[model samples]
Target chain A: MKKLINDKERFLSDMLDGLKQRDPHIEIIEDTVVVRKEKKSSGVALVSGGGSGHEPAHAGYVSQGMLDGAVCGEVFTSPTPDKVLAAIKAVDNGDGVLLIIKNYSGDVMNFEMAQEMAEAEGHHVASVVVRDDVAIDNEEQRRGVAGTVVVHKYAGYLAEQGASLDDIVKKVKEMMSTLYSIGMAIHPCLVPTTGEYGFDLAEDEMEIGIGIHGEKGISREKSASVDKIVNRLLDELFKHTDSSRLIVMVNGMGATPESELSIVTKYVMEALDDRGITVSKLLVGDYMTALDMQGFSLTILDEDDEVLEALDADTGSKYFK
Target chain B: MKKLINDKERFLSDMLDGLKQRDPHIEIIEDTVVVRKEKKSSGVALVSGGGSGHEPAHAGYVSQGMLDGAVCGEVFTSPTPDKVLAAIKAVDNGDGVLLIIKNYSGDVMNFEMAQEMAEAEGHHVASVVVRDDVAIDNEEQRRGVAGTVVVHKYAGYLAEQGASLDDIVKKVKEMMSTLYSIGMAIHPCLVPTTGEYGFDLAEDEMEIGIGIHGEKGISREKSASVDKIVNRLLDELFKHTDSSRLIVMVNGMGATPESELSIVTKYVMEALDDRGITVSKLLVGDYMTALDMQGFSLTILDEDDEVLEALDADTGSKYFK
Candidate 1:
């Protein structure tokens, strides 16, 4: 797989043209598939995206407190609805837009066909659909990986501080009923147009709920140790956590190690401080990655403290502050 | 080789106790290594560190514009000069301390014995050392990986605007004569307490330069093509580049993939736009990583335009904004 790409679907548009030629106030939108392009305001507007092998998912998280537009789909595929109706008409703003979707099934039927073509272009749209991954315990075919990095940072930080689209889809399904994310792969993520590899796991094995386009994992076993893989992903994120409004992410299935995500955030913070559970915000790294693919993933949310102070706000990223 | 560690010589002091419990403005001293007690301002006090397997090197880069103190060591081991003289006496003030250090040999004789014991406790110490690893081009052991992340982001933005100690050691040795860095590797980088993994290479092998602790690599081959390893790391970073101030970076040798660092920044931006070069800031993902080691590494850095707008600042890290 000798790559340096010029074509191969312009690897995420030449890595978003080297991120808008290294940030000239970032704005990218050729045929809409996002990373915020401007002309946004009036209210609502928080369109997210998926699949482009999650490089800075939903477009390096759009910006200005998170997402205003993003609809890519060619790394794990699922963005057609005319590129989510050109990212809901380039971040709609006649006051109404909120797409944050992630519950797979072709990203919930292509964000419900771009929310019925942005309600036939009359704007006003709404959709939350996150089904955060609890591996698989019949949350009706549970899937959607890494809770779309916390629904693109709390519905793009409440649609950039002007929340609307029904209060940003009612606080993103009220933080997706206490969000939960689970992952683990240990290795298997190559998909540069079938350079093969999307599932393997052998040197000691591991699988858990794998599926960030590499799918495959209900269990696989053997890989053990990192507190037995964070106590089997905190026993399915504390069996769908509810109160104890926590927010711990120990991600990194993009070939793990920020010193093994601080040793899986010290065993998911000692299994959420042995259940007395307090954790307010703590994302260990490789936010929802799965490309180089080794393994890691745990994502509990159930947060109050306003989605844990907007997931400890302040962000830019070379590895999350 | 499985670890979530409780011991491995207390994995860098339980990762500075989960990085000071995920930031209570980080302050950890215990088994005496150091990392300041956050907001203890007293100006010109920018110390730095080495080794602790470089996770967020120099302790998640200290903070408040950046780095007042940081000394870590064990894992690649180097910290003792009484822990860089307790990080230059926990960030000395009266406008003096600097340190930075990275040209290894036990981090230049333990930051030159913590700058002669902070000039025999009178302070006003100075140091600099970062020999910007151009893959050890002999002339002396030549080490110091990933141009020490641009000398801790330009010596932590010039010791957060105070800049003294011989003008932050003459602009960190003019950023080590316009830095160069190189790296590669593919497999071989374990050492989290001898979990082994140093030089083995094979599944399509690779290796070139490689050092950030899993050391060993001047050149090994057979895994080419990320444009022949970005044309042999831009032919050893344009051999001491003067291609009119380049700045590149690619990085991610901690299990590569920001889509293979955008295919090594698309053949390092078509070999620095076919050598007419003029980068002015580029940086790709996984800066200074080696832990989950798969491979990558480019780092250029020539600089100008006020050090390329502080390497085009604005960072928090979803893998370098």
Candidate 2:
């Protein structure tokens, strides 16, 4: 592997160490859970987690006005139920806690187990599963990708506003229902455990409708222009929703450069404008990544003024802020 | 080229379009300049610029408390003297403007000519040329790299505090002298104009003491572990300075992932601790880039509490905030 890492065994722990070193306001618990240094005493604390590779997601979002804690698993793997339960116990204040789960089977099952375990321990816990990827035809099989961060932002905003756990879960589910994300990966991400890529693509070819975990995409084709790829992605996205306005996130799937992301944004925004759809708020960066995958994802969140406000609300997370 | 560009000729303009679309408070002038929508009239306006591909540097820093204007050239090329002159004129309030020039020969010569032209037009202007790289032995010939952003942050904070133009220049020059940086590239960055990488490295090799513009480095070796590579870079950097405290930036040279950047930060912070150097403020992200180079640079500024506070100050720029 061409990755800058020590032992593959220590990748997660070492990464968290690096993350903690950069942000003084974060603390790692038992080396698997990241919590805000000063946990708020009231309201529903937001918690999210998944595999370790998609950085600045669950952990970077752990802060005030965002997630209170993130329970990280190893790369391309789900955290244990014990770790998730520990994360819940760390950040759950008097009101309760909400867990945001991406729709991968492993993550969903593990986070749900933790939720049940936490609830049995007399802590009120609610969960919202994000299945926002429209690439798959079956809703039950759709996998969450970059749009999960938007769910975190909106839920964290509502939770910070002192909404009840039930209300936060309801609002988050509503948002998730309307949100859609689709990715195109030109290269597969490396798996540390195997020291190999999850998949492969030719130097001059591309895959459309890819997922975060390097699952088989909808189709493969010779590398087309970015504008054409964007049009294809957006055409798929626009089919499922009639919302006239959207909150957009043009997220890099790890190794894509900001220059390319900016170019992608230009084309995406221009295409949307040409279609008479207004983008209320747009975020362009590498918020959710697939290790070193060379691709980008477009996440469209159907939004009104309130949803846009929620997404734009102030957050203490270094990445989101 | 594996770039997400519509036309190579329109790359820079399209990028500015995307940037402006994302942030409504920024505006483009003369097709190659970025300026704050509402220039503050009472203080020294900060302006900086160079080549294009370094996204979120000169242009992204153009905001209320950071930079008032950024004059951009085409990819990897310096802006023309007339464009620099236009930028100075655009942001120069009655209080004069400060030009932050990276120490590339083309940039220094062009910006100096612009300064002369602006002064000839009766506009007071002062320029602080940054040459913070420690790799080059000849001080007069060293090129500015990522450390230029630190100069910008510190000087911008001081300018926002209403410091005199002379005082700002003096303090900035002092900081510039104390600042040191060095980078290692795992792969060469592709230049849009040439549609090719500036240099080549084998898959298992790396270049040490590299420049942002793809100038050859001091040495090349088989790709050592990140920790060893970081130690070598810091070894060279420490020989030139004896700063007790540092404000460090672990900057990605374009396509480096945040995960790898975090790993680099872990080793760097550990090394600094081993050397008894205290790091007050450490930022780990892609601030300055060399197109899509898969490498990183370490920038250290000798800073006390005041300088740290200056770096942590609020800015209207979306990237820095």
Candidate 3:
């Protein structure tokens, strides 16, 4: 595996060190959680996290108007409850704290454990699960993908607006209902710890509906043109939402070139325009990424004026913009 | 080779279409150039462009405080003089325009042609060539690589401050003198049009001092750990500058993961700290990229108070932040 790393065991800590060094707005705590250096001190603090590989997701969102703290774990591994509790304690103000947990089995369990621990300590904490990935037919099995970032933005904006933790949870849950995401991969990523490829694929094949951690997708087929692939993902996504106006995110799996992402973005816009769906806001880039996975994901959120205002609100995030 | 493209011939145009659709801040002109939608009406307009593969370079930098226009060519091919002229005319609002060209033979020839054409039409235009790559010992042969984006930010800031085209040119040239960059690649990228790899590498080999176009670098050696590789590149870059305070950018060639880039940023910070050099500012991510190349480049600029202010200035660019 050709990867730029040293001592695979130190990957997470090393990455976090680099992150804190690059941005002054965030500081690392408990050697695993990243929190805003400037505490909110008044409004409800928004906290989110999961595995570490999907970067700029949990930690990258830890900025003034976004996440207050992000509890990071090893690559594709959930953080312990203690680490999550540390993040809660570090960011929670008098207003309370909200946890934006992606709907992964490991993540949900650990974050909930942390919530219970924090509540036992007299901290008021509410948690919301983002199950936006539409690859699976069962809602319970849906895995949150790139759409989780929108949850961060919305929840962060609400918290910044002085919304109660309960109100932020309610609004974020409402937004999550309309969020849908689907991904396809041309090549699978190699997990650094095990030195294993997430999955195997032939040169001319692609996997549709792949998850961020290289989980198996819904189908594997001969690779087609960009439009066909984008349309296929959109078809699955359209079934989950009927909203005419939407916020679209074209997120790259770790290794896809920006040029190719732009091509994917072009076809996505064209496909949406054909369906008469108006894209109220569009973001195209690698926001949440799998480690060295060569693919892209399409995420769409039903748009309302409030959500648009929140997304457009200014933030101190170095990555979100 | 696997790629997410339709007709290789339409790569540039399709990517441009997507870019224009995704961002409202910039508009496409002459079917090849990207210019600001809200053009600056009374200040010197900064314009930059070159080949299409290195994304978020010239085009992504087109925004309120950055380049007023970006002329894009076919992948790895210099844009025609006509497109550059169109960008120059479209953005020049009588206060004159400045061209920021990278140091490539084809690019220098084409942009100069455009400048001559614009000058003949009674428009004031000044141009600066960035030769920051330290891989090549000959000053004239040094390629621009990723440091050109710094030029855009600096020049853009000056233009926003109402600096004359001549003044912008002089200051940018001065800044360019202090800029230095070096890169290393683990694997070469595939060219979409020709369906060929830029270069061949053995399983455990890497190329050092590679250019953005996958051009031959200074050396090829057995792959090593991230820190050693980073130190090797830094050694070459440090030979060109001796400033105690610096601004650093660790840029990814298209396919490197954000996780690896963070690790690189960590080592870079440590190396600078050990040398007693203070990093005034640091940017870590894929800023300028070669299409699907798996590697990174490090760029350091000798920083002064004026340079720091310019780098910190805000812009409407979707990619720069």
Candidate 4:
């Protein structure tokens, strides 16, 4: 696969070790759980995690104003319930713990199992599944993509503010409902274990509405121009939500250059301007990635004043800031 | 080339427009200059620039605690002396201005010309050329690479500290001497104008000691394991200089995934550990990049107390913080 890893099975561990070396504010718990070094005495601890291929997503979010802990699993695989429970136990201050689960079957199941296990031990635990992908017709099947980062920011802000678990979960659920995302993948990513791409497409073709895990996209089409691609993604996103003031994120699906992300963001901004939408806050970077997938995703959040304040809150998470 | 650019000719401008849209603290001047919105009232204005393709290096560093302004030219081409002069005029408050030029023939000549012009226009100006590339045997031919960011951080901190132009330039020159960098490119990047890869390498080949502008490296070798490649690079870097305390950066060359960077960094840390070199501060990510080049560069600075303090200083530059 021409990957820069020592061993395919040890890729996630090596990555986490590297991250811990760079960021002193975080430490590893039970080998798979990454948590803040200075735990809060009492507050709703925010925890989010999934597969490990998404750089700076779940682990990078483990900081002061963002996630308290992130339980990392194998690449494109969910962490076991024991690992998630360990993360919850490590970061739960005294109030409670909230797990921000992305709407993937394995992730939802494992996180829910962990939540139940934690609750059985007399600890307050709540879960919110983020399903912001707009391409899927059925809400139950909609996959959470890069838009989950928005939920993390808002919910983490509330947790840092000493909000109750119920309050943070309720707010995050509302934010998830308002958020919408869809992506186009120019190329599929390689899986380290198999040393093969998850899928393949013709050079002139792209997978529209692709999930972050290299899952089957909604459709395959001839790769169009950047503007046309942006228009298509935005058309679907705008159909799901509309607002004069909004918060937006142009997320990379890994391997995409920052310059290209900026280009995509430029057209997305132009598209929003055409609709007379005022972008209150915008984030342009790889908050969530898909393991070297060459494409970008557009995320729009219909945020209120409180949500905006939370999004702007101070977070030690370098990815968020 | 699968670049997300609108017009090949307008790529740089479009990228700048995208940057301005995301960062409200930065504004463009004279169409080719990016300056901080609020200029330093009376301090040494730090100016640095090269080609346009290095995203976030010269421009993204223009913040309160970083460069006062960045002069941008065409892709992989140096800016005209007039553009550099305009940036100097725009940001020079009352104290003076200092130019941080990477040791490229075009950049050195153009920035020197601009310095002379600015001097003639009654502005105190000085320049320092950073030639930290260690792969080249001849000192005159050594090209500046990712280590220049270390110079920016130190010089920008000094500028923000209200140090005089002479003082900032002196300290930066000393820093430049202690820095050394080496890089490897697995794949060549496409130039926007030509729409062709700058250089070609076989599927099993890699170019070692490559410059940021896709210049020829010291040698081509069979693409070996990541550990073997990192060892070779580190062997050269360590041969140039060794110290008990150092600051290191593992910079991605645009198209390399963040996970791979982390993987590279993992081995880097282990290599340092084996050598018993303690890294005081570590910076990892795409600080300076060639246009979508799939590789990475390692920069090691034998940093003393002052340089370490400056590296840790607060800067409005998002890439740094």
Regions more than 4 Å wrong, model 4: none
lDDT of 3 by residue, B1-321 (tens): 589997899999999898888777788988999998987889998888999899877788888888899999999999999989999999999999999999999999999999999999999998999998999999998898899998888898998898888888889988888999999999898899989899999979999999998687889999998889988998998888788999999999999988888888899899889888998899887889999999999999987777888888998887776
True contacts kept of each: 0.36, 0.62, 0.79, 0.52
Q: What's the TM for model 2?
A: 0.98
Question: lDDT per residue, candidate 1, B66-99, as tens digits?
Answer: 5767788787888788878877776775787777
TM-score of each: 0.33, 0.98, 0.98, 0.98
Considering the two chains of model 3, state its CAPRI-style docking category: medium
Model 3 TM-score is 0.98
Q: Per-residue lDDT of A71-105 in model 1, one digit per residue for the tens? A: 77777888788778777877776887778777788
Point to the candidate with the largest DockQ: 3
Q: Taking the candidates one at a time, how many backbone clashes does each contain?
A: 13, 0, 0, 0
Cα deviation of B276, candidate 1, in Å: 8.8
Measured by C-alpha RMSD in angstroms, how accurate is candidate 2? 1.3
Across all candidates, the chain A TM-score values are 0.37, 0.98, 0.98, 0.98
Q: Judge candidate 4 at residue A235 and give its lDDT.
A: 86
Error of 3 at A306 (Å): 1.3
Model 2 chain B weakest 10-residue run by lDDT: B312-321
Per-residue C-alpha lDDT of model 2 across residues A34-110, encoded as one tens digit per residue: 99999889999988999988988779888888889999999889999999999999998879999999988899899
Poorly placed runs, candidate 2 (over 4 Å)? none
Candidate 4, residues A204-319: lDDT per residue as tens digits? 78888988887768989887878889898888888887677888889988888777777777788998898899998899898888888889889998858988998888888778
